[model samples]
Target: MSDQPVNLVSVNTAPERAKKVIGTVIENVKDKYTIVHAGNSATIDGVKPLLLSIQPPPGILFCASMWTPEEQAEIQQIARETIPGIRTHAIPTGLQVQVGPDGVIKYLMERIDDIMKV
Candidate 1:
């Protein structure tokens, strides 16, 4: 409340409310410090899209991103064993993926038969 201006930005530490939000980030994000919060609605709005993006999907193709590690053998194993005519390519890290080429195309194409059988 002083008339003299003071830099209060660093004065505050992340509180218990912010602490609670860390649990909600995904397994990947939990390894880093990326939580965002404000004391109000604008803060919540800023973070909504990120939370939505991390939500797990219902099937194989759902795991696609621009790229994930080449070492997610479990997902690949499930795709190969359970789905037909599906193959995976392991592109190197940080190379751009092709447009009009769905990264998870193999998985998506295989989903039709599984979905129909279900």
Candidate 2:
């Protein structure tokens, strides 16, 4: 698990009512990664809103921080329960310091590097 690679998925919204979430991951994330861009509909039993449509579950599921710790916990729980063997890591969402994309990306990369060293 220590040597596992990280994945980064970008969820961009579209103007059309159909196909809300474009399941696309950053090409440079790794040689292998999973991108599950589910619809905006709510999930049952307090689970995360997003759903996984891909067959043969992904090896890793990456999550970002939520506005509150409780929300973060809920997302983490959802990922953990949904995929039996998938490992998940959540970094800061840059909301506290209100940083721009570059700063957020730098900080996230640093955090991931630190995690990989462990």
Q: Which candidate is the best by TM-score?
A: 2
Candidate 2 lDDT score at position 97: 48
Per-residue lDDT tens digits for candidate 1, residues 1-118, read: 1232111000012333222322232122323322232221112222223222332311212222233564334444444454433343333222224422233233333342342232
Clash pairs detected, candidate 1: none
TM-score of 2: 0.50
Tens-digit lDDT track of model 2 for 14-87? 21211221222223233433233333222233333343653444444444432355555566677668766555
| Top lDDT model | 2
Q: Which ten residues in a row have the lowest lDDT in candidate 1?
A: 4-13
Q: For all candidates, what are the clash counts? A: 0, 0
Query: How many clashes does the backbone of model 2 have?
Result: 0
TM-score to native of every candidate shown: 0.22, 0.50
